[model samples]
Target: MNKYRITVADKNPLVLSGLETLFKNDDRFILTGTARTGAEFIELAAQNKFDIGVTGWEMPGLDGRAILDAIGEFEYHPKIVIYTGVPNPRIIREAMLNGAAGFYAKGDSTEQLITTVASVAAGQMVFPYFDLKKLQDDPWESLTRRELDLLDYLKTGQSNQQIANYLGLSVNTIKFHLKNLYTKLGVKNRAQAVAVSLSRKSNH
Candidate 1:
C-alpha cells in the first residue's frame, strides 16, 4: 500500500492539533508538515514534497485561495484539498479549476474529510458535500474570457485606475467593464463585486 505524504495548513490550533493526531495515527499517511500561517504554509510547500495538502480557505496573512493562486503552477505542487467554511459556489469552482483535487466544507463530518483525502490521494476526483449541477443552475452564470482576465486583476486588490493602467484601457472603459461585471455578478460596488467575482469558479 502506498503511504501518501501529507502537509496540512490551518489557522486554528485546535484543528491543526486534531489533524496532526489523526495523520500520526494513520498508517497510510505520513505527516510531513503542519502550518498555522499562510506564509509558513507557503514556505513549507516550497521546501518539502507532499502527496496531498489539506488546507482551509482563510489563513493568516494570505487566504487559501490566494495561496493557491501563488504557487499553483509549480512543478512540485501537491494535489490540494480545500477544507474551508466558506461555501461560496464561486470559490468552490475556482479552487477546482485552479487544480484542487477536492473541496470539503467544514460542516462535513471528519469521516468525510478522511475519505476525501484518501480518494484524492488515490487520484480520484471527489466533491463530497457540494452540488456541481446546482451551481451550474444558480443565479451566477459563466463569465466571459475578458471578464475572467479582468477578474484576475481585481483579486489583487487593485484600484480601477490601476486596473485600467495594467490592462491598457482607458479609465472610463475600465469603469464600463466594471459596471458590466457587477451587473453580471449581481453585486453592488467594486469590492463586493470583486469578492464575488474572485470567489466564482464557473469555467464556462
Candidate 2:
C-alpha cells in the first residue's frame, strides 16, 4: 500500500515537533516535510508533491489563506487541512472557499485531528465543531443563489468591482445584491457581511 504523504507548517516549534512525533509511529501517513512558516511551506510545496498539507491559519511570513491561494494557482494542488487555533467562521469560510478539504481547531482531540486528516485525504469535507441548527436558522439562509455567489466572492476578500467582473455582473447589480445581503445578515459593511456569512455556515 502507498503511504499517505503529508506536510505540516506552523509557527510553533513544539507543535511541529509534536506533529512529527505523532506521525512518526503511524505507518498509514508519512510526514514528508515540516516548516516553521507559511512561506517556507509554500516553497516546499512548490518543490514537492504531497497528498495533504496541514497548516495553521495564521503564521509568520505568509498566512494560510495566502498560501492556499498560491497553491490554487498551481496546476497540481494538494488537499489542504487547516489545523488552526482560530475557529472563527470567517476564517473557516475563507479556507473552504479556497478549496480546503478540512478545518480542525487546535483544541480538538488528537483522534479528531487524525480522523479529519484521514477523511480529507480520502476527499471528504470536514468542518470544525459547530451547531448545525444555528446555521439553518440564520436569516442569510434565505439568500438567493446570486446573492450567495456574491457572498462567496466577498469572502475571498474581493472588492465589489472585482466581484462584478468575476460574476459577469454590473457594478450596480453587485451593489444591489450587496445591499440586500447586508440587510439580511444585519451587517453594515463587506467585512462584517463576510464574517456573518462565515459564522452562519460554521453553525452547520
Q: In candidate 1, residue 96 scores what lDDT?
A: 76
Q: In model 1, which runs have C-alpha deviations exceeding 4 angstroms?
A: 129-180, 186-204
lDDT of the candidates, in the order given: 0.80, 0.83
lDDT of 1 by residue, 1-204 (tens): 889999998899999998888888889999999999878877888899788988887787777666787668677868888888875777777777767888988887887788989999989977745677887676453453356667778878888899888767898998888777777788887788766755665533
TM-score of each: 0.70, 0.66
How well is each residue in 48-67 modelled by candidate 2, as lDDT tens digits? 88899999988886787678
Q: Name the TM-score of candidate 2.
A: 0.66
RMSD of each: 7.0, 7.5
Which model scores highest in lDDT?
A: 2
